[model samples]
Target: LDSVLVTLEEVTVCFSVEEWALLEEWQRELHREVTAATEQLLASLGRWNLWGLLDMGKILGGSGF
Candidate 1:
């Protein structure tokens, strides 16, 4: 995993300025979509009491769903 991350970093560093800007723009868009979706799901879970069913301790411990 560490090696893969390093390789990805190196490759990203080689991108032209325009390419990098585009990549960053795409990443921001993806982040926005993901955050919106997560919020919507959490809201639904709350309505159904499913969010309360989850273990708070596990979530705080970084155990992602």
Candidate 2:
């Protein structure tokens, strides 16, 4: 994640107010996609190993985080 952020910092982005609003929408979309992905991953793991997946779900704060 640190490496990804470092790469991001080197990238330049320019946004007007409208563009910023669009960017915010895109961020929310990405967040939802990420949440869905994590949930899928947790569900898949839970099916194979419920106990370990339960611990991982705790560390990930389940759906709250």
Candidate 3:
């Protein structure tokens, strides 16, 4: 995983200024979408009392980033 991240960073470093800016913008948008989805999921879980139905440990433990 570390190696992959290093490779990705190297590739990103090769991008032109405009391309880097666009990539940064896209990443920000993706982060916002993920945050919104997480908020909605939490709200639904709270409303439905589904907390015990899901495993929070496994869900939050992975470093997928």
Each candidate structure's TM-score, on Cα atoms with residue i matched to residue i, is: 0.36, 0.36, 0.36
TM-score of 1: 0.36
Q: lDDT of all the models against the reference?
A: 0.41, 0.45, 0.40
Clashes of each: 0, 0, 0
Off by over 4 Å in 1: 1-23, 47-65
- Per-residue lDDT tens digits of candidate 1, residues 1-65? 35322222332223333443556666746644654465466567553233432433244342221
Which tens-of-lDDT digit does each residue in 1-65 have in candidate 3?
35322222332113333443556666746744654465466566553233422332234332111
**Candidate 2 lDDT, tens digit per residue, 1-65?**
35322322232232344544555656746654664565566567553333543454465444321
Clashing residue pairs in candidate 3 are none
lDDT over C-alpha atoms for residue 6 of model 2: 30
Candidate 1 residue 42 C-alpha distance from true site, Å: 0.3
Residue 44 local lDDT, model 1: 71
Which candidate number would show the highest lDDT if scored against the true structure? 2
Location of the lowest summed lDDT over 10 successive residues in candidate 1: 4-13
